[model samples]
Each structure stands twice: as structure tokens, then as C-alpha cells.
Target: MALFSARRGSGLAAWLLAGSLACLLLVLVDASRMAEERTRERAHGRALVARVGLTDLALFNEARYTRHLSQADRHAAFQDHPGALEHFPAGSLAGPARPSP
Candidate 1:
């Protein structure tokens, strides 16, 4: 007598498919619930911005040049020397600042 039979109809594949479907359903349900909450949060954020007048979002805390991309100077990253390599990790991730019109 074999401990496990090769012809056994355990339906393991069906069970895995059903489990994945259940998880997907839970994610969709959670997203629907959060949609309403996000709308309210966005409105609150807008009101706060209007009242406090917030500045640009800080992208990286590593260096001053990488902190605010909009206000960052292109040459600020090369403070050490003109041909010096970027010391900050965030500097490589961020592209050059947009030219002012």
C-alpha cells in the first residue's frame, strides 16, 4: 500500500485558484472602502494648503540640492568641485532641474 496515491483527486489546483480569487476580492473591496476616505482626505489637504500655504514637497533628506527639485540649482550638486562625482545617493535618481521660462 502506497502512502500517497498518484491517482488521488485532491483538487489542489482548484483550491489554489479559489484562494487567489478570494484575495483579489478582498483587495477590490478594500479599495472601494478607501475611495471615500481618500476623497475626504484630499479635501482636507487642499483646505490645509490654502490656509497654511505649504511649499514644495521635500523629495530627499540627503542633501539641500535634492530636497526640493523645483527650487534646486543645477550646479549645487557639484559644490565640492566642477568635475566632482555626485556624493549624495539621491542626486543620481533626480534629473537636472527644469529651466525657468
Candidate 2:
């Protein structure tokens, strides 16, 4: 009876140890995968920001060109008819007004 009990106790301890090791390994693998995912997310965020910045630069260039053209047109209009400005409204020289929502 004593021998049987000792053998049973040893078997139980081995089983518990194996289960604990398995759980530890699983946790380690999950943690590693999470770390990799975070790294990928950060890279994607950086790429997105770069793309947005490039788009903003292009828009800024286009706006600058439009502004230059509007200024030129105003100058030409005033030069062509000096008295025409006095007959027009106050905001007439500012180009077409933006439509309200």
C-alpha cells in the first residue's frame, strides 16, 4: 500500500509539471505574436502619415497656382477699366464667393 501511494503521488506531480510547462509555452508564443502585430501596426501608421503628407503638399501647390491666377486676373481687370471698380460691389474684386451650405 505504501509503495502504491508513493507511485501515485509521483505520477500526479509529473502531470502537474507538464501542464504548467505547456501553459507557460503557450503564453510565450502568444506574447511573441502580439509583439509582432504591434510592430506591423506602427509601420503601417508611419506609411499612412507619409502618404497624407504627400497629398497635402500637392494640394498646397494647386492652391498656390489658383491664387496666382486670381491675382493676375484682378490686376488685368483693374488695368483694363479703372472706373469699373467703383461701379462694382465691395467684394466683387475678390472673385466668386464660396457658396454657403
Give the alpha carbon lDDT tens digit for every residue of 47-79 in model 2.
Answer: 987877533222222233233433334443344
RMSD of 2: 19.5
Please estimate how well model 2 matches the true structure, expressed as its whole-model Cα lDDT.
Answer: 0.54
User: Per-residue lDDT of 1-101 in model 1, one digit per residue for the tens?
Assistant: 24333345445555667789999999999997899999988898788778988655655877777776656666677666544678888767765544569
Q: How far is 40's C-alpha from truth in model 1 (Å)? A: 2.3
| Backbone clash tally (model 1) | 0
**RMSD for each model, in Å, please?**
5.7, 19.5
Residue 61 C-alpha lDDT in model 2: 26
Model 1 stretches with alpha carbons more than 4 Å out:
1-10, 78-84, 98-101
Winning model by lDDT: 1
